[model samples]
Target: MARGAIPPLPVWAGEALDLITDMPSAEDLVTAMATQAEGALIRAGRR
Candidate 1:
């Protein structure tokens, strides 16, 4: 693949991707999940 290009997803993964009709793109979902995980960790550290 060219620089910065994402490699092709596997067949099962491609099918799973199609099921996500209303969700944000995978990259956006990953970022949002990372943010939430970080917030949870910070909160736990304060306990």
Candidate 2:
């Protein structure tokens, strides 16, 4: 988040917490979720 990277969500879905001090768009959150999975895969050498 500090580096502008999206962190992964918790196992259970809940209300969104705006940590950026600003509201995030639906698409932005979706992209963050996707990027999180991709980042994990990359760490496992899958990407």
Q: lDDT values of the candidates? A: 0.82, 0.74
Q: Write the per-residue lDDT of candidate 1 for residues 1-47, one digit (tens) a residue.
A: 58977767796588787888767888998999999999998999952
Off by over 4 Å in 1: 1-22
lDDT of 2: 0.74
* lDDT over C-alpha atoms for residue 15 of model 1: 75
- Point to the candidate with the largest TM-score: 1
Q: Which stretches of candidate 2 lie over 4 Å from their true place?
A: 1-22
Q: What is candidate 2's lDDT per residue for 1-47, written digit by digit as tens?
A: 47966666761233344454467788999999999999999999999
